[model samples]
Target: MEKEEIIYGAHSVIEALKSEKSIEKIILNKGQRNEFYEEITQLAKEQQVKVSFVPQVKFRKYENLNHQEIIAFTSPVKFADFETIIESILSKKESVLFLVLDGVTDVRNLGSIIRTAECTGVDAIILPKNNSAGVNKDTVKTSAGAIFKIPICKVDHVHDALFYFQSSGIQLIAATEKTDNYIYNQEVNAKVALVMGDENKGISNATLKQVDAKVKLPLLGSIESLNVSVACGAMLYEIVRRKTQ
Candidate 1:
């Protein structure tokens, strides 16, 4: 029983093999042979992605549909280069928008953020390659397939990406209750990256130190904190309203 997220269809798997997607493994039907078989095997070998051959009985779940005789269990989100995606976006849009996740380790939270980010026209999502939930089955499910719609940059450090964003003339706004500044007070009409931190710890002091501003959504409830996704959606929609209206 494979437990990872699966992407079937020869075109989909072939594109994944050609890109920088983290493909955990590929399974081929031993009884099936087609023109794409050689291409898929060669690309997988070149990318050093693991491939497995099994009987067609293993694909019983997908027998009713056209899976193109191939299955690829992969991290469906392809990571873009931090510098390259930034430069590319800046080249076209004078006012850009981005989201930064600081050690958000929950896959579902990450997915929800991705969904909101996509809906709000976020240029890309920056995440630390380490200590992050990243894309997975639950993430994809939570995002309602929005994971594939947005550009994601997996970098070595959150600080590095923040610094780069600043150098590129984009502002960094940290979303946290640590500050008195509210989301509505901040100006996100220009190029900016909204930074959200971990669920328990909030924004790290180290990360907060580098942000241009620290802002938070007003809380009237008894609780001091909100779920990361809900807070993020509120903040992003505020930005969207500012940018659009």
Candidate 2:
């Protein structure tokens, strides 16, 4: 069955309305009103998007989340072809910071990664259609609704996607403790795609071999590796920081 898409929080909902994206409806908390609420209402009216006010408790049931007094249920994030993603990066004149997950199945980890990706300004996140977590209620709640703002594309095979990006002049970098290369020292300015493996087994050898470079996050203590989400955040922001500097 197809899962529903949810966008919560007043700021996120407001942005969705202001943008050209399609919104199914706006679910606001009952008895809540102020400048923000009024503005959202007017904007929804102008856009002709339906608005439904429910009790805080009832609205919580829609997302099973702490809706922050506002929530917006929209259609699934629009998925596009690989050619579209490549064209988008080319048009923006931005070095691509693409993330490809091999087989990360945990919903929470995927959700957290989505949140971090949005904050780090990643170009797009590519995941395999099978053996990957699909965005749902828990994911939306865990992402704090940031999934609504980020673009997620599902591919038939991650390896094919990597090759497609590589052919486009995008370097594929892998994060694994097995590598001698340090992620912090890597040149992040080039058109690069960062590949993170699943939490349990890390990257498969077949996938690892395709990587242009393998990098590791420094472990200061006894811990061998960072959690998938944490490692992704560290690596992503490092790329962003270095590129902008």
Candidate 3:
């Protein structure tokens, strides 16, 4: 497996703590002083990973070290298979909430969106194998440790995943600016899959046609569009809010 780049921020390091992959080692600035240090030490102990503190300059060479003053090196990023994700979610027997990214290439956007999705009770996050950002240390950092808690599935073809979800009784709701139905007004009953498209293109015409419902966020600002992740948060919470109500 190809190794992903290392991440050195607190949130990214914490998410790495929760991942199943073995953390070969962790590095910290010598005599690191912070409330989060206790948690990091505890987590490292729990995972049986070795931790050591080096000079602050050493950590500064690789990590942001704004607060935690810690960095970690772990195994390569693992991408889950589509079937495995489907089977796992089905076995859980919970209401399905999937967040799909169509050509979202920004790592921070993907990470922030995943964080929001996890908070909103999304079951899985789906991305196309190509043209989509995969799990990286920066992504984990941006997600604030939420990346470890959520299932991220990368597929050869996004349309195949959508087709599979639809066959598995999940409804596809595409979040786009070019839609008449606002997300707040939509019915997200049954298993729901919410798709957020690229920042530049929005959803492709072909993909939009495959969606069961095309919903837009109510924009009351001078700005024409919201960031994809922010828009996704809005749509996802709406689903959670409507379902539980």
Off by over 4 Å in 2: 1-76
Q: If ranked by lDDT, best first, what sequence of candidates would result?
A: 1, 2, 3
Top-scoring candidate (TM-score): 1
Q: Which lDDT tens digits does candidate 3 get at residues 45-122?
A: 775566778887776555434645677776445556778888888888668788889999888998899899989988
lDDT for position 198 in model 3 = 93
Which stretches of candidate 3 lie above 4 Å from their native place?
1-76
TM-score of 1: 0.72
lDDT of each candidate versus the true structure:
0.85, 0.80, 0.79
Residue-by-residue lDDT tens digits, candidate 1, 1-245:
12456789999999978884677568899988899889999998776566788998889988876887799987666678889988999999987899999989888998999999999899999987666774677888999878788888878789988988888888899998888998888877489889999988888999999999999988898998899999999998898788777
Q: What TM-scores do the predictions have?
A: 0.72, 0.68, 0.70
Model 3 lDDT on a 0 to 1 scale: 0.79
Worst 10 residues of 1 by lDDT: 1-10
Best by lDDT: 1
RMSD of each: 7.9, 11.7, 11.2
lDDT value, residue 136 of candidate 1: 71
Q: How many residue pairs clash in each candidate?
A: 0, 0, 0
Comparing 1 and 3 on lDDT, the stronger one: 1
